[model samples]
Target: MTSAPVDQQDSLAAWLSIRTTVPWPRWSGERAAAGPPAADGVRDYFTATRGDRDPEGTARVLTALDRALADAQEGRQLNFALLTGWQRYVLHRDPVGFRTLPAFAKGGRERYGLAADTAARFEQCLSQSTQPDLPLPSRAARTYLDVLFFHPFEDGNARAAMLALAFVLACDGACLDQAHPLQVTRWADDADGAADLAVLIGILISATQRRQRHRSPA
Candidate 1:
């Protein structure tokens, strides 16, 4: 007789336990230029990845990204409600809610367990996006990873993560011109990988700002 499939550890818990301990990189890079907004990496990601196969879906994601950016500009706090508003547009459905059951990803190699307070915990994490002490890149990276490991939505979590990352950066007056570099697989237990993501964001932010400076007239 074959043994039963082992229950995967809760990746969400793994993330929460180490979220604050990760050695997030410090960012001293110049902010994105105020004039002529930076190229939106989220839009590029969606268009290039899904434009051909699902044009309509791509359109929906772009719409959601615009709305999310608007909300960020208006200084709206990132929270479950804010994300759900975007998710409605993403899924083309009304009344999106947190998943009530365990969510799995990566071919079921990772599982996000749900508890009575999972939603509350997620909201607590989102609020930290505006934490005054942390650097923008660190906040952005943590928020992105939070969405990823939490697996809050039944579907479209990856889209949600990208949207959150964009919103975080936009709130801090930054945006990445290229996002393809961020498409790699992320494991919940890898603290070093999480820190590296912040470092990469800093590099991208600096590169985008540098390019903008070069293009600007003296």
Candidate 2:
């Protein structure tokens, strides 16, 4: 994987202040409002299914994420093992794990992630997302963007990114109503993409909070 640009890193750090005040909703209320917190909803967010081409992979991914989210809701911070398990499920055929060579995507034609030799750097990125100083939206968005830019897994990086985002939010007792928007129109090299991603997470935070408030009566 290619190294992240310094300017983009700086921009991401600066964005923590941009949406720090929006309160993260508690999972307890979400469970109450939605009738129960279900991992199936997360699968629904991606329209995940055990189709012929990748049968069982979708179910495995969903099961892994459900366990991850449940752990997060209980106040467990994300770890490499959690993410690796998710990837193993998503790319069940390749459980030996992560790309062993440089990777690239169409948007940024070259050096899209840290070179395959730098597993420690990727672990550091996941570690940083656990820092408490940043707000939920910032942490969640940064983790999502990190997964996008880091491109850690050999396949199903997008699913990993969304799961990273959801795990961060769940750690803070929040969740998004929809996550499909995160799967497209992202540019690893664009500062605006980073900023917009934070904004979108903030929007989802606010929308989810609004729904939860309605679900609870004063």
Candidate 3:
């Protein structure tokens, strides 16, 4: 809930959480790279998992994620589980790909100086679930909820945060509007939490509702 426009000028902390062109995801060599025209490893992974969406398979995949989260919260190693979840979900449903959180790059530098607060904000988000009384954005926008509380990675903190929100939206029947490159660039320019969270949430919600209205019922 706590919806409202982001403080573009003051949101430096928010801006510091994302990634740039150099020194990509931490998993690049171990897995694949992040960004457009992904690495060969990424293409190969996608090729391997590409298949029809088996509802059962999807359910199992989701169950695995739940298990992974539980294990993580209980002090178990969950990097594999989280990475696997994103990979398999990408195979089962393209929509899920929008929620992917890139691994951290080395030398955690901050263009926006948010390192001190990333964990704090993430913890704050985890404490508050999206309650009925708390209006939310579209499903897609909300799906990234996982990354917010999970703190699954260190470098791509912002991506993780948004991904967490996107995940929440998807699961709650709200539509998600993957951030537009233009919008991202603009926000990047701010390099501050200057962006308005509430405004973005509202936009995502409205866009998703409009799209859902026209789709035939499943």
Q: Model 2, residue 95: displacement in angstroms?
A: 3.7
lDDT of each: 0.90, 0.62, 0.35
lDDT winner = 1
Candidate 1 residue spans exceeding 4 A from truth? 1-6
Tens-digit lDDT string for candidate 2 (32-124) = 233333323356765543444565676777776887787787776576677887677677654546677556555334344344445666677
Worst 10 residues of 1 by lDDT: 1-10
Model 3 error, position 41 (Å): 23
Which scores better on TM-score, 1 or 3?
1
Ranking by lDDT: 1, 2, 3
Superposition TM-score, candidate 3 onto the true structure: 0.37
The best candidate by TM-score is 1
lDDT of 2 at 54: 62
Clashing pairs in 2: 1-113, 1-114, 1-115, 2-113, 2-114
| Candidate 1 lDDT score relative to the true structure | 0.90
| Candidate 3 C-alpha lDDT tens digits along 104-212 | 2212221222354454554444434344444444222222323432333432333334434434543444433334421332333231222244446565455444454
TM-score of 2: 0.73
Q: After superposition, how far is residue 120 of candidate 1 from its true place, in Å?
A: 0.2
